[model samples]
Target chain A: MCGIVGLFLKKDDLRPQLGDMLTDMLITMTDRGPDSAGIAIYGPETEGMVKITVQSDSPETAFAHLDAALCAAIDAPVTIKVIDTHAVLTVPEASEAAAIAWLEETGLRIMGSGASMEIYKEVGLPKDVAARFGLREMGGSHGIGHTRMATESAVTTMGAHPFSTADDQCLVHNGSLSNHNQMRRTLARKGVFTRSENDTEVGAAYISSRIAEGATLGEALEGTIKDLDGFFTFVTGTRNGFGVVRDPIACKPAVMAETEDYVAFASEYRAFADLPGIEAARVWEPEPATVYFWER
Target chain B: MTTTLDMTATDLRAVNTTLQAAARAQANEDYEIINPRGAHAMACGLDGPLTVTIKGSTGYYCAGMNKEATVTVEGSAGPGVAENMMSGIVTIEGDASQYAGATGHGGLLNIKGNASSRCGISMKGIDIVVHGNIGHMSAFMAQKGNLVVLGDAGDALGDSLYEARLFVRGSVKSLGADCIEKEMRPEHLEILAKLLEQAGADAKPEEFKRYGSARKLYNFNIDHADEY
Candidate 1:
């Protein structure tokens, strides 16, 4: 089992509350999946690195190469944080075209990227992970987080989520994707690269490529329902807004509560309990094979 | 001591207050729960000779850490009820949810009605007796336990399993990997009778059948690895 959440903040005034609020939500779901935690945030006007996260078996070896290659790779200095097997770095702001290239070439296989989308992840408890990324006081209008149990792939940072596509769109998942290898083969044919064995990454890239073309988040999500097999509850973070989707069976659990201030979704209700005055917020399961999207 | 809870109140603090008050008012070794709501995680980790008689339905993980305590529910239960019970007795008067006796190390679970999937999954050493129909994967991965299903069973029963004795009286959809049907011996019948008596069951000894592991998964070999 895994816990996933995404938020679309309608009001800019609520941006400052995003990190703390999302952190609280992630903490509540710690029990569902405790292997690792990851987050991706997107803002309308920010120029951010489509960040790529990876965890090499040896952090020391990984860091030496990262530090040496920072100057040759991008135009600006690299901002990086390291702990244990996990690490995150901001690849100084780059254009959509350059960002895409930088993401694919990161020393680690490009499982996903957060650009204009601030991505954060760590290998520990939800709150501990947020603390590792200094998320407690940080603020953003839209973001997503995941706690993974690793039913399909080995529990590693490389396999953890918030997968990206087309260097812009990012996606997180709560259930298994049955048609993973088939989807990967198709994406590979289109020159889209996949880094990890995780099936969610393929789906993320699939959505990212679609949004890059012209389809809206909802259309791309609904389109994948028939193509992507197996049980899946997805939360996508996009430039315009955030959206959620579920597979036909709804075998995985997901509940969403939309308030005047924010739209929050989680695998369970306990995670979103601290959303100011939103006590037990009318939590209801999202319909199977349905997708919901909104932006403000 | 007999105490009942109101169904309207969702807050456990109010209901706990009643249970605590009843425990304080009565000095007897056995206690009774008169009216229970759809409360979850009830009577978790309780000890001593207290007997909790739930009057109505309950939610998830009731009597989770039952020690010397004995809890009897008058109605059905939600998921994970009696999960990880260490030692004691948990009796359900009606149907039980999935993982009815999941990972229970030691205890006696008596289900009078149907039981959902994974009824005795990952049981450590507990004894569970279900009087009616049971769902799929009834003993999926049970490590050590005595499971008695007096009715029909479903597919993958005892799949990828461990040392657990399963007794079913009706049709079994399918047996899991390395699992096979066993004989109902006189000694095993006596053991079943003792378990039934603990569960407050009054069924005849002849009305049961036995099923368990073939022990093929215990040893490792190139040919058998794929079967696992």
Candidate 2:
């Protein structure tokens, strides 16, 4: 099991200082997920072709080689960088789907891609990852963080989440995708490149691609909800705002506490027990198959 | 003296106020409570040397989160009694609902009657005594607790049990995953006797049988998960 926390509010909304509160929420849930942590802040640049992650052990060299290939293949400049263990790339003019297919043809797996979000993750305790990326200081109107305990995938930075693309779509998840391999095949036929072995990233890419192609985040999530099998509390943040929903069967635990100040969700009540104003607040479980969303 | 708190005073704050008044009335002395009508979470979130008694049935989470307090319910209780409790005594004079004694870090729970499903789930370091039968899935996922049932137990007893010892006197409906019936020793009988005596159950320990985990699911082995 993993723990996920996200705060959503309208732009320039008046809310109290919650830096320490958010950290405390994450810290309280360390027992649920002890592997890795990552968070992404969505801001101004919300356009352009998405950079898809391709997993090659030689991330730096693989990204460099793939950059040259994309440049030669699409006749457009490709921007690349070796961020920690994973490499991120942005193609100036080519469609993200086309770039993903081109990269897959070269046998490199696409890790993640989006134009609206920047994602950073690594393997370790939450504090270790927080210290690495300085998560304490990162702030946004809405942001999501994940502490993963690598069940189906290796305990690596790649498995850590709030998987983002060059576009503005980012997602963090708690629970498994039992039918991920089958869904990955379906996405592959549509030229969606998936890099990480973690099924969460695959689900993120699928939903984000749908939203990028004119589907609302809620609609894309609704489409994926029927397609996605097994227990999951899927939470996604788009440029419009942030939305959280759960799968049909209520197999995993997800509790919610929302106020005009902000909305937050976690795998347990104890995680959100210390949130500001949660005392005397209404706390309830996210019912199975229900779409209770908060957007501003 | 015993007093009556009617059903309308069922809210937590109301119950807290009454309990405080009761505490003051019985200051520096032993006390008892009677005729609390359908109040959920009665005497919950309290810590004291005070002894509380509830005479009738209850709703969810009765006597939850007690500390150093001795609570006695003469009738049936709802779910989650003594949940996450630390250092106390909660004796149910009748049957109890699911999740009884859940996550109890310390204390003793004496159920003079039967216990419903999921009893002692996730229990930690508490001593539980059940004089009568217990329902299905009792003690499921229990950790570091001692559950003693002088009578029978229902299906799936001690499912996913972790370091918790269960002693049942009669037939088990079925053993749960990773749980096994063990040979009862003289030392275990002594322990059961002491627990029964504490609960005023006065049952014979020789009639009881012990159950516990087989220790297979401790480390999260992928291959062995199918067995779970």
Candidate 3:
């Protein structure tokens, strides 16, 4: 079991409160799944620049001289911002692939790579995880958070959610996949490698592979109902949009609220009670097997 | 005595504790619960004839296992509202999510708006009345009681039903196995009339068609194997 929370702001004024609102939303679901938690935030982006968020067990050594090493290897200017155990690196857009490759060879794990998105996750109570990363002060256009209770995999940071393998794409899941091992092998054969043994990571890779092959977000999500077998409610975020889908059975609980200012998705209605102007929001459950997406 | 509890500050446990104390003392008190904010398991295990009115929406399993209180939700309800209730009156002013009144043994559950799928599954003597439409598979495997749907009934109504009387004023998409349209005798019409009056519904009893178990597969008969 897990808790998934997502917010896509339609109004720019609410961006400053994105982290604060998301933090409140995630913590409300602490009773749902309290093992581990993670979040992915999509913030402002610069022209022709990409950001790569990475996590290290020992940040003092893993991050030291990392910017200089990457800048020298890729022959491009790279800047890094360290927040606790995670670091966000900004580099020339063209060198993103090369920089990622260079970092991987140096035995560093890349959490996420996108034009504006940065992912931070760890194994702990959601409240502690959020406090460790100072998540309440960060702001973004759209964000997704997950609190996980391990079912198929061991409880570890690598098993936590917001698994992103492609640029500008990440997904958090609330249910288990019945056929993930088969699909994982299928994705691996197509050259999409998921770094963790978590089933949710395989789900994320499947969507990324589909989008990489030029399928629209809706089409890719629809494909999940046919190709993947499981009870799942997936909330995915891209550079410009947020998407939600439930399996045909829709066994997991998911509620969505949309207003003039923003669209929110949560595993339960309590997560939405604290949002600003929520009493007037159009609250309802998304239909089973249907893809609901919103873009800025 | 009548009291008011503000859930936004007092939390759910305090409200429950106060109600439990009132019930233990047999004080037929009236309570006003404000700002429930979609919390689960509110007003559960009520065993006294008290009046508890919730001012806002509630999350899952609200009013579950109620014994004798009269509970009312001023707003919508999440899944399993009034589930496993042995006795009482639970009313919803707005729509209800899935499994409303599920596995109830004895109670009167009334929903002013639509109810989602599995409205009264496995019911055992509860009287459920939905003013609006109900989703698929309602009254599945019900052992006994009455289900009155004033609006339309979705697919597979009363599947595997056993002795439960279902009255639908609107169309039924399909009937479940062992469930079939039955003759609405005067006794059934009288039951429906009483149910409508108890629920404060406006629909006429004559507009509804009664449904129940066919009893064709109630016992093991090789001749009915094909039907099974």
Candidate 4:
């Protein structure tokens, strides 16, 4: 079991409160999953620039000289901002691929890469993880968070959620996949690599591959009802949209709330109680085998 | 005298203690629970006659195993509302999520709005009245109870049903094994009328259809092998 949450802001005034609100919602679900926590934030983007978030077990050594090394390798100016074990590297859009290849050679794991997204996660309680990363002090337009119970994989930083396979797209899951091994093999044959053994990451990669092949987010989610096996409720965030889907049986619980200001999702309603103007929000349970996505 | 408890404190333990206290008092005690905010396990394990009103929605297992208390929710309810209840009255003013009134025993549960799948599943003794539709697999394995629905039932209604009586004013998508339509006789209408009266529903019993077990699979008869 795990807790997953996502928020897509409709009003620009609430962007600054994104992290604070999301942190409270994630913390409220601590009892659902207490092993590890992670979040993906989509902030403002600038023209001709891309950001890649990466984490390292030995941040002190791996991060040292990283900006200089990558700048020289890509022959482009690079900037790195370090926060705990995670760092966000900004580079010219044309140099994104080169920068990622260089980082991969350096042996640092790529958490996420996109024009505007950054992911941070670790093996610890959500409250502690949020505090360590100073999550509440940060601001963004849309974000998703996960607290995992480690039902299928080991409890490690790489095993945490908010898995991303493509730029500006990430997903958090609340259930297990029965056919991930087969799906992972199929994806590998097609040249899409999934970095972790967790089924959630496989699901993320599946959606990303579908989108990469030119399918809409809605179409990719609808395909899961037929292609993927096992009970699952997925909340995926792209640069401009927030999407939700559940398996046909819908064995896992999921609730969604929408207001004039934002669209929010959680494993339960308690996570939404603390949101501003929630009493007036339109609350409902997303139907099984249906995809609901909202874009700004 | 009436007491009010604001749940902004989010202290479920304290909210339940006050409910227990109100139940045992000699005088007629009334309570208003404000800002429930979808907290789980509210009004659980009550054993005394009292009136309690919750101002907002609740989470999982709200009012589970209740007895002798009249509890009401002003808004929607999450999964398993009034689950396994025994001898009480729980009223939901809005929609209920999945498994409403599951495994209930001896209670009156009224959902003014829709209830999701598996409503009144494994019911031993409960009277459930829903003004709106119910999802699939409702009343499955019910031993003894009455389910009254004003709206349509989804796929597989009354699956594996036993002893329990079902009355639906709307259509049934399908019936599970050994569960079939039965004649709405005068006695059945009379029983349904009383249930409707108790639930404050404004529907005529004669306008409904009755469903129950065919009893063919009750004793594991070998003659029904193909059907099984």
Candidate 5:
């Protein structure tokens, strides 16, 4: 079993509390998935700059002098902020591809790259991972967190969820996909590749490929219900939208609550018990094979 | 007197142990649980007469295996609420998650709001009344009892059923294998009326249609062996 929690703030005032709220929500779901935890926060954005989140086993050595070296190599200004094993490198938007290539050549694993999103994940308990990243102090407009129990792959750092395959687009899943191996081959033939052996990463790559082919976020999520087999309750995020969808046979539990201020999704109601104004939110379970999306 | 147990202050095991002891001793007391916060398995395994009112929502398996105890959740419930219940009544003021009242033996499970998939699956002699719609694969392999729905039923309702009576006031998307629409006889109406009254449902019994097993797949004939 896995736990997924997503929060989309409709009001600008709640942006500062997004990380704190999401941290509590993710920790409450510790029992649902204790193998690993991850979070993707869509924080403040800078014009003409892109953020590339990368993780290294030895951040002290790998990150040292990395920004200066990348700046000189790409001939563009690069600033890296290290948080635990992960670092967010902000580079010129025009030089993102070059920066990513150079960073990849350095053997650093790219977690995600986007205009505003920063992804952090590790193999540990949810509370420990949250503490390691100081997740409670961060702020964002929206975010998605995942606690994984590792059904389809090993419990490694790469297996942790909030798998991001495209810029500012990520997905966290609660159920196992039965046809991921077959689907992985189909995507590979289309020039789309996944980094990890995790089934959820394949799901993420599939969504990213669909979006790259000019599908909307809602349409890409709807395609999952038709193409992907087995049970799944997926919560996906983009630059300006958050989407949710469940498979036809929705054995995996999902509960959503929407107030005037925010839209929240979780694998269970317990994850939402402490949200602000939750006592009066319009809470309901998303129907099977239906795509529900909220856009800014 | 109504004893209050605050879950935020006392742990879940201690609270459940207190309620279980009350049931075993037949304390016949009223207990109010506060700050449930969607905790799983709240007030389970009771065997005697008692009254439990959970102030907020609960997690999985709430009021499971109940006997002679009337447990009420003032808010919603998670999965497997009242599962395997033996007797007495369990009520939910709000919606219930998947597999509500699954494999229950006896007593009444009244969900005032919607119930997700697999409601009353493999139920044996239990009576469940859902005021709102139920999801797919409900009452699959149900043995005996009554499932009354005041609203619509999702796809594949009552698949592979066995003797359980299903009454729906609204539309049914589809019926499962070995399940078909059955005539509403006077005896069936009698059962429906009693359950509706006990569940505090306002729907009239005459507005419903009954469904049950066709009994074709029960015996496994050689002609249908390839289909299986």
Candidate 6:
């Protein structure tokens, strides 16, 4: 089993506390999974700049002088902020492709890239992963977190959740897919390939491919219900939207709570017990095979 | 007197052990559980008379294998509430997750709100009354007991059932294989009436449609050997 938590703040007043609230919620579900933890935050967007999050096992040498190297390689301004084993590289929007290509050549794993999204994930407990990333101090408008139990893949940093295949888009899953290999082959024929052998990565790539083909977030999620064959309760985060969908035979548990301030999703209600005004929130389980989305 | 237990202060094992001891002694006490925070296995496996009221929602297996206890959840319950209960009354004021009261031998499970998939699945000698709808594949292979639903039922109600009685007041999405609607006779009406009253449901018994097994799949016959 795995645990997934997502928070989409409806009001800007709660943006500053998004990380704190999501971290607490994820920790409450630590018992559901102990293999690895991951989180994706949609923070404030800087005009003309894109953020590329990368990870390396040895950050001391991997991140050393990374800003100047990337600046020279892309022939543009670059800034790198190191946090534990991960770093967020901010560069010109036009240089995103060059920067990503240069980072890939250096053997750094690209976690995600977007104007507003920064992803941090590692092979450890949720609490430790959150602490290493200074999750409590970070601020965002919406975020998604996952604690994986490692069923379809090994317990490695690459296997952690919140798999991102597109800019400002990510997905975290709670159930395993049986037909991921088949789907992966189908996607490869269309020029969409996954980096890891993990099944959830294929799921993320599927959704991104759909969105790239001009499908809306709701449509992309509905496509999963028809195309993806397995037990799944998926929470996907885009630039300004948070979407949820469960398979028709949804055995994996999911609970959602919504207040005027925010919309929260968790594997259990225990994660929501500490939210402000939780007593007055409208809480319920999402219907199977139905797509629910909240957008600004 | 009402004894209060704060989940944040006391561990779950200690709280359950204390209640179990009181039940074994036949103390017949009343307990109030506060700040449940959706914890699993709240107030389970009692052997004597006791009244437990949980102030908030609970996680999986709340009141499982209950005996001679009246456990009430003021809020929603997670999966497998009152599972395999021997004898008792388990009540949920809010909705319940999947497989509520599954395989219970004897008990009355009352849900004021909707119950998710497989509500009362494989039930044996238990009485379940739902105030709202029940989800898909409910009462699958039910061997015995009465399941009363005041609202609609999801797909495949009472699939491959045996001897158990199903009473639905609203429309059924579809019936499962070998589970068909039977005429609501006087005895079934009486059973439904008693279960509804005990569960505090307001619907009239005459509005329900009874369903049971066609007695086709369980027994073997020489003529059906080729099909098997």
The CA lDDT of each predicted structure is 0.73, 0.71, 0.91, 0.91, 0.94, 0.94
CAPRI verdict on model 3? medium
Model 6 chain A worst lDDT window (10 residues): A279-288
Runs with alpha carbons beyond 4 Å of true place in candidate 4: B26-28, B221-228
- What value of lDDT does candidate 4 attain over all alpha carbons? 0.91
Tens-place lDDT digits, model 1, residues B1-228: 344445454356655544445444544355555444445677776654567787766666888867666788877676688898887788988777778989999989999988866788889898999998777777888889899888889778888778889888788988989888888899889988888787777676678877788888787879765876
lDDT digits (tens) for residues A71-137 of candidate 4: 9999999999999999999999999998998898889999999998999999999999999899998
lDDT tens readout by residue for model 5, B34-143: 99999999999999999999999999999999999999999999999999999999999999999999999999999999999899999999999999999999999999
CA RMSD of all predictions? 10.6, 13.3, 2.3, 1.9, 0.9, 1.1
Best by lDDT: 5
* TM-score against truth, every candidate: 0.57, 0.53, 0.94, 0.95, 0.99, 0.98
Q: Over the stretch A1-296, how does candidate 6's per-residue lDDT look in tens digits?
A: 99999999999988899999999998998999888999999998889999999999999999999999999999999998999999999999999999999999999999999999999999989999999999998899999999989999989999999999999999999999999999999999999989899999999999999999999999999999999999899999999979999998889999999999999999999999999998788888898899999999
Please give fnat for model 4. Answer: 0.48
- Model 2's DockQ score: 0.04
Clashes by residue pair, model 1:
A50-A114, A50-A115, A51-A114, B33-B53
lDDT of 1 at A120: 60
- Native-contact recovery for every candidate? 0.00, 0.00, 0.39, 0.48, 0.70, 0.57
Candidate 2 C-alpha lDDT tens digits along B120-166: 88888888888877767778888886999877887788888899899
TM-score, model 2 to reference: 0.53
Complex DockQ per candidate: 0.04, 0.04, 0.58, 0.69, 0.82, 0.78
Say which prediction, candidate 3 or candidate 5, comes out ahead on TM-score: 5
Number of the top DockQ candidate: 5
lDDT of 3 by residue, A151-238 (tens): 9798987889899979999999999998999999999899989999888898999999999999999999999999988889999999
What is candidate 6's lDDT per residue for B1-228, written digit by digit as tens?
999999999999998998899888898899999999899999999888999999999999999999999999999999999999999899999999999999999989999999999999999989889999999999999999989999999999999899899999999999988999999999888888888888888988999999999999887788978986
Predicted complex 6: DockQ? 0.78
